[model samples]
Target: MQDSAAGAATMKALRRRRGLSLAGTARALTNVAAELRLPALPAVASVQRSVARWEAARPTRPDDRYQLLLGHLYARTPAGSIAIGPGSDFAELLTALHLLGEGERRTAELRTAVLRAATDQGAGMLSLLSPALQAQLAAALADPARTTDETVAGLAAAVADVNGQVGTLPMVRLQLLLAPAVDAARRLLAAPVPSAPLQESLREAAVAAYTVAARLAFETRDDEASRAAYTAATREAAQLGRPWRQAGVHMSHALTTMYATHDLAAARVLADRAVRAAQRGESILVRARAHALQAEMLARAGQARQVDTALRLAWYDMEANHAGDPAVTSFSAGHLRGFEGVCELHVGDPATAHDRFAHSAAALAAPRELVQRAIVTVDQALARIRMGAPQDAVELLHQSVDAAAATGGRVPALRLRDARQALRPWRQETWVMDLDDHLLDGLGA
Candidate 1:
């Protein structure tokens, strides 16, 4: 009973970290009861009150069975037939895993059963489980061979089931649940990582989480949070022990420095770190991304030859490695391409800049990403304006602003501000004046 009570307390803590409401927790419990074919009416109410009491300034008896259920619920995997009454030992095991970041030996035994259940009736698990479990399952399914299209389909079905059962949860919990997806994605890109269709789905989930957190940070101008999340994501990528992923983290950090803050020297240092890490891994894709970012930062510092050298490396690395289209970058490679093109123009190569911007914009077109799309769009518009296409530039800038507004992103808005400042002298020659006025009116910068 004491062990279960302790587990119950941990469960409550996880819920609090996730920021779930009592009603939301109750709904999740109700869904769990229904899935288990247990009595829902009073049991769910009991769980709800117990959870509330745990949250309050009082003490409640820790129910072992309840804590076990909560672990299974948060785990998103099948609890199997483990005896889970008030004195069960599973609660202690789970508590240890949560606090120590290491699951017990029994956790591995449960893995097979969990995988079987995730493969078979994963839909039920999804329906009865919380966001945290769903995220873990997404990570587990990231192997390509094991997680084929069928596997991804199963996982998606499970996610949908859980979505239907629990509806929307607190944003923070949802974010935490998605963290594993990001971890899984790094695995997919790593050298020893497995290739699974479920990996693609997991990648999509990770991207979703990044987009949300990045957008929130950009909107609130929370540079600290933005730096922290991006850095943490990079750390996760590096932990996967893949050169490309490590480089990708470096590139991401570089971009965060470039656009999120005004630290060019720090940005260059990060870019250097990315280049070195990618080189160490012998990952052509990673090297190319790092070089390209380096070029952008160098251009900012008025180093023309360095820009040329960086782009040269980018092109050469992609060609040598037979890498796939330079897909990954610090700030969405496709959009950063436009900014790179603008760098060429700054160094007195309008034609080259024009071509680069066009290619970059085409690559970035209609992405599902709100934040990436907006950043790329803003760069694209600026590139066009520099290339003497004022009308197209104006329209593109407007679209960029709209996209940024949708995500509530002040960083992109600030980028737009920089573009406007550059075109200040020609404000009357195009629609730049009106758009600039609008931006200043709302953004106050």
Candidate 2:
């Protein structure tokens, strides 16, 4: 059963933030449970059944609060329609804000009902609108008078919904949703707000848009756009006094610089900045990641022992902070392990690198991000190459290159070039000769 109403609200807000479906939320809970190493786990099938029941709108047992929270969190929309008029009480704004703050956990039925009511002025019991009526409704929402704090917050949640859907929708549909929200956010922020809470809300909206824009830029391999977007997010986060968000932007910049351009010096500077911000904020995971990334940059620059020392220091720091889960921040134990593997490969410790790579690959198995997976493979191949198996390295390189192409990322391509170069001495060997020609051809070398 679920906890108190406040607990429900908390779960709902978090679920909405994650943008998961009921089934998806349930699955995530399972993953999080395993990640946290919790015992007394529910079977996947049982969770699925519970989700199905919730989706069907059947009344669930009260003790199932966690399940209900998961259901609500996974809900596609809010549960009720809320409207604020010209003469509406300001308290309504508080109510609307409260709902938005619920994060992401709402039952699907509740969300569906809410969206229907909010978007459709007269849903079911209200008027089933004609095309003209629907247009009128939209026009009414567009009316300048309707842009109250409550309405604006509702719109912000709508934007979050779109952004969340962006991961699953076709690009065109995602753009259709995101563009309007971005425009709306810009307009809202431009308007006068009476309070700090209002400003913070608008700032968060800007940050969210910037984050999405950065992701889109990276997806298209537009480094300039990526950097610009990160800058935008950083500015907003700074304004909101959100140090963790600032750290996130810096880390992202470091990643793009390091992997996209192979600019070790620049990467190191950005990573160092990120580390300092994370430390200042007492963000253990982010600091650990910054340390690990700094180590990676050093290794790439041929500082093996220094890389090892940095990793050791970061690992110890992580232990001291009792960094519970990488999921808590952009940095994770898994990410550190991957970074360690990459450094090991560079420092001529193939065996140790292989083990770390294996740990990274296994740890990141459930939520697959293509660019990250490619990095792991490239690291693994580097380890293999260092172990004197150019053939195996070439095969892993092939996989990495293919995956990177799908992401339009250049990092894996750069790694492939280095891997092939390592095999240059063995090019005359029958096992490596054809592979070399194929690799060069693949890279247009």
Candidate 3:
């Protein structure tokens, strides 16, 4: 087929219709190559990359090995499956293949529209982008079939970059970014790499992708989606067979179950799993966070003594923690303080909760911490209400809901609702009424 957008679109459609990743496509080629003992066949990694390049229909990279191997994989699978379904889709690919026809134009238009919706979301979301991001997005809009040449290291960086933006982007928008990224990482993990180290790196990247995916899925209030992402992440981390990796995965699961789902029993179990794994691993950060999560789980259960013990252990872990394990979860002293505030509130000590929350200023004040800041802001407001000064919480509650508007705003929206529930006792106060009006009014920014 000639290098054209329609050609690329047809190829991608065939693959998607097959419900396979790029690596799954690579597997078909490699399996055929091995069956025939095809000598000098391109490496599995090369085939995966070529599939990517082919699907882009880049002019410079004309197709090679356009023989039985490609036949067994692409051209044949559909015809064989057709004995089993869509003449309409195949018609598009076939007409597009003739290379300058009506089918080509129509197919490409629909493809571009769907791709733009997946990537850009909408003009309102797009308008909020920085000029540089907008330019980058413009290029993507211009070429729906284009993709980056992703190396293992490049994929890792992409995963890291997406994870780093967790709280910054709205949950729905973040899911859009993460969906393609996670697909890429999972595809790479499925492909065969030349070296053990490269394989390990891909596994690491996949776990990290799923970790953030679980958080975003949970934040979007899709409990089943979050569970599926966590299951995949834990499976990948287990395949790595590293305690630190498991620690990271379980810690993420613990946080989700505890905060988002309120599954305290499961949270306790996951938190203990994280602590055990961290104990056997090298990240002091993970160690500290694990204990802190354990403390929160216990606090929520009203076990004050155990909570204090866990909190003390976590403080020591943080004080002594100088370990930086990128292979593990990212944490900060701010996270520990937030955990302490949670513990304090759950243990019926609003004064201490307020005091503890003061140290979480960094979580609430950072520009990049949109979702997290809203969560902590709500917590701070709750502390004020619990301390018999419901009036003091109104301003902070307003700030929390405003942050909700700025972010994709689901997770924090729930928090804002629960905060409202907590304010029912003082609903007659003028400040409470105004706060209610502000929240009811699209959480005015």
Candidate 4:
């Protein structure tokens, strides 16, 4: 293995046998890190370079973490392992070796058990008359130990970090982060824990993970997965008995219903539920978010009076709430303004919508909010189109499309498509045709 050519050939062969591209292998390593609760996961680029180094046999042996991941990836068991060592923790080594040995069967059984536990809330009695059968049952029912408060808090922070990165990262990369987090959260929920506080914290973390998953799914134009994730979040939030969590879940569901399904009535209902849930909580941030969602739904429904009332309520709540916990609710003046701008557009106030969008875009200066700013810019462009400024709309639309394409945001891509259709009256105009051509070139349409 120390021979450069032989090591390079072996590494390349292993990767090929797994049928994974360099990027795919990097993503798989990320997922393995998340699932195993590793302290650190390498960046995709780092993993890509490492693969290249291995294929080149540059006298580099990856650290323990990468070695374990590689072993797992290649299905190396205890008998066939190349990485397990005396310094490795015995329990972890055994677990990894066992999983590698029975990967498919164990994965299927664990998935089935998790689903059953989630659906039933209790497992059925198993026949354990024999010692061998008892051992098998014990192994099947084993769960990870309860995590510490600090660990739980760290997991929550990790989810928030991913949420903040959504605007900056490409959709595929975000999904890679989110999928494993969601899976780990669900697995934690299925495991038995001793403390109520631990359970509550886990539920909260799970709710956040599920909400982020739902948001990502919505952005990627996966309506069914979005709804399912929202439903799962709602369920987890309900288990925690936290009105703020419930309100957040409902608000997320309302957004999906409004944007993805175009079910305005259902959106309104969900928004109302969110508002009611928030009213039962002390978190003014949650209450304000609920009101803002209500405003958007009402605006879409053409209820101008109700929309204004909802916005006013949200404003009042925000004024009263001087502080907020992002882990619980991420409502801010800028976010409210963006929502208001969207509502204003729907309520036939293109000028106000444009102004609001401009303000919101200026306020949203965070690097992670780039995609969001681009989205608002696109909406502002739509307002311009409504105000009979097709040329300005075309320019803004081009900027928005470029920004969205950079991040692979499906929602903005869809909006750009709609904007193109809206320019049908001026389709034959030179600028309009040029915009269309640019769009086609960018989108490979």
lDDT value for model 4: 0.70
lDDT of candidate model 1 versus the reference: 0.56
Location of the lowest summed lDDT over 10 successive residues in candidate 1: 162-171
Tens digit of per-residue lDDT, candidate 1, span 214-282: 434534666787666675555545545456556665676677677766889998998988888877765
Q: Could you say which candidate leads in TM-score?
A: 4
Per-model tally of clashing residue pairs: 4, 26, 1, 0
Model 4 Cα displacement at 443 (Å)? 3.0
TM-score per model over all chains: 0.51, 0.59, 0.65, 0.66
Q: For model 4, how does the per-residue alpha-carbon lDDT over 1-445 read when each residue is reduced to its tens digit?
A: 1244654565666677657888887888787677667766668988888767656635344444676666454432233322211222222323432323334333333322222222232211111012233233244235546355654555575576567666666665566656755776787788876588888887998899999999888888888998899989988888777797898889888877777777888888998999999998768888988899889888877899999999999999888835554434366788889889989899858998989988888887765677878888888888899988989999888888778877777767777888888899998999988887777777664
C-alpha lDDT of residue 65 in model 4: 62
Report model 3's TM-score to 2 decimal places.
0.65
Better of 1 and 3 by TM-score: 3
Q: Indicate whether candidate 1 or candidate 2 has the larger lDDT.
A: 2
Poorly placed runs, candidate 4 (over 4 Å)? 1-143, 324-329
RMSD per prediction, one decimal?
16.8, 12.1, 17.4, 13.0
Better of 2 and 4 by TM-score: 4
The clash tally of candidate 4 reads: 0
Q: Is candidate 1 or candidate 2 better by TM-score?
A: 2
For the record, the alpha-carbon RMSD of candidate 3 to the native fold, in angstroms, is 17.4
State the TM-score for model 2: 0.59
